[model samples]
Target: MSLRIDNQTCYFDTDTLHERLPANTVTVITDSDKPMSAVEVAGQRIHITEAQAGALTVAGATAGRRYLRATDGDSVI
Candidate 1:
């Protein structure tokens, strides 16, 4: 027997430009190696699926819901 769930996997990259974050935006978790800091989560990150990332922002995101960025290239994700 096999069980399957309709859920998409997500992957986000750090922002190379490091621009300032706008208002009403939410950050997603990307750091799988280590737990993300609360402060970092609030100020950066975009909770978006890989498919939805192309249209969101950065000329790649696929959905507006996944436009969050770290505003820095060296940002720990």
Candidate 2:
């Protein structure tokens, strides 16, 4: 899965989920080593299927941008 933030809108894309976040909100990406069963953004949680965890990239405004990803048992980036 991948997440992108543009201005006040956030686009979250994955094989099973695609969502647009509200404007001017803080999103806290959870940090967990276990394969993701769900994702939280803007205080909303969306469940996901079991799969190999992927990388995360967050870039945009300073105050509203944040990202977290689960380490694949090796390292956390």
Candidate 3:
């Protein structure tokens, strides 16, 4: 998986699932921080399976905050 940050938005791309599965859980980790509410995937309350050909957008991230880690369940990629 790859993570890209733009302002307060985070874009996550992965190639693990061939089909759209149910929404998974997303955790955005920053320096010494737990998952925050502002971070989300596709604007969903939960992490939904991204389209096979598209990337997942995690919006509402804290401004000026640098994200060092992100995960979907046990699969980081």
Off by over 4 Å in 1: 1-44, 57-77
Ranking by TM-score: 2, 3, 1
Arranged by lDDT, best first: 2, 3, 1
Q: In terms of lDDT, which candidate is stronger, 2 or 3?
A: 2
User: Between 1 and 2, whose lDDT is larger?
Assistant: 2
Q: How badly does each model clash, as a count of residue pairs?
A: 19, 0, 0
- The per-model lDDT (C-alpha) reads 0.32, 0.46, 0.37
| Best of the two (2, 3) by TM-score | 2
Clashing pairs in 2: none
lDDT of 3: 0.37
- Top lDDT: which candidate number? 2
Candidate 3 lDDT tens digits, 1-77: 44554553445555542222222233432322533323244543333222311232234322323445555578663
Please provide, for model 1 over 1-77, each residue's C-alpha lDDT reduced to its tens digit, 9 standing for 90 to 100.
11111223222335532333331242333444333211132245433344333333333212223224565789984
lDDT per residue for candidate 2 within 46-69, as digits (tens), equals: 443333112122332223122556
Cα-based lDDT at residue 10, candidate 2: 61
TM-score per candidate, chains pooled = 0.21, 0.38, 0.25
